[model samples]
Target: MTQSAARPAGRRGQRLTYLVKRLEMAERARMEEVLRPLGVTLHQYTALSILEAREGLSSAQLARRHVVTPQAMHQLIATMERDRLIERRPDEGNRRILRAWLTEHGVQVLKECHRAVDDVEERMLSRLAPEEAVAFGSALERCLESLTVPPEGLARHGDRTA
Candidate 1:
């Protein structure tokens, strides 16, 4: 039996997973509540940042950067287009390719969303010293890296030889 099986009903990762999901949903809702008043979604804000940071990216490239499928990116782009927050136009070098850019309205909205995220992070992590928060973030990254497996390979807790 797996370790999860040995544990009491729902007293494990699944429970933890649910809690994490709820926390994320709640946080996202809070972010939306703040951003909606200014006319934007968190995903839209992230896309705006990517657009500002990258000079030229096709929908496919942007989708890959965000680890989402092109279809999803198209939908997001369409919504942003309707909101006048972004523009998709043919790339100069490749007519078949499309590039996305943030509009001036998009820039203003992103700035506000950035401030909101900063405020949220500061409020949420106020209990932790800055260094402790940095260290904890680094540890989370390490834990995630440890969970990676070689192609066609697997391990239990990253310790089993395979």
Candidate 2:
């Protein structure tokens, strides 16, 4: 009998990719549950956090960072603007480009979200020791870089290939 035929099927937990996807889904669900009462989704909170770090990202730039299409990002930006969580202004160098930044209210909301997220993360890492948690984070970062970096190692941040 073949090696594959010798084993039973439906062993999703044994697959690395399946476990990764399952973890991602669980994290997203928990984040959304906590963020819902704050009138923000996980994507919106991510955008807000990004804006806080870099205050002048264009819609296209933000979309690229989020790995989403520009049209979808535009809709998200529109919703954020409607909620007065962020404001956009024409870029000084490029009149056609709109750069976004967090409003005062946005900052307040983001701070609250940070505390809530910190709680979630603390719970998630509760089983691990501090050193183990650090190692786990480093491992995850290495895994991400392995997938994102090009085979030739020529691509930088904005130059990632599909």
**Best of the candidates, TM-score:** 2
Angstrom error of the Cα, residue 5, model 1: value is 17
Q: Which runs of model 1 end up more than 4 angstroms from their true locations?
A: 1-22, 148-162
- Poorly placed runs, candidate 2 (over 4 Å): 1-13, 154-162
Q: 1-162, model 1: which lDDT tens digit per residue?
A: 799765434335456446557757877877777788777877877778888899468999999887788898899989998998888789888899988888888778788888988887777668899999898677556545555654344454443333
Which candidate ranks first by lDDT, i.e. highest? Answer: 2
Supply candidate 1's per-residue lDDT for 141. 63
Q: What are the lDDT figures for the candidates, one per model?
A: 0.77, 0.87
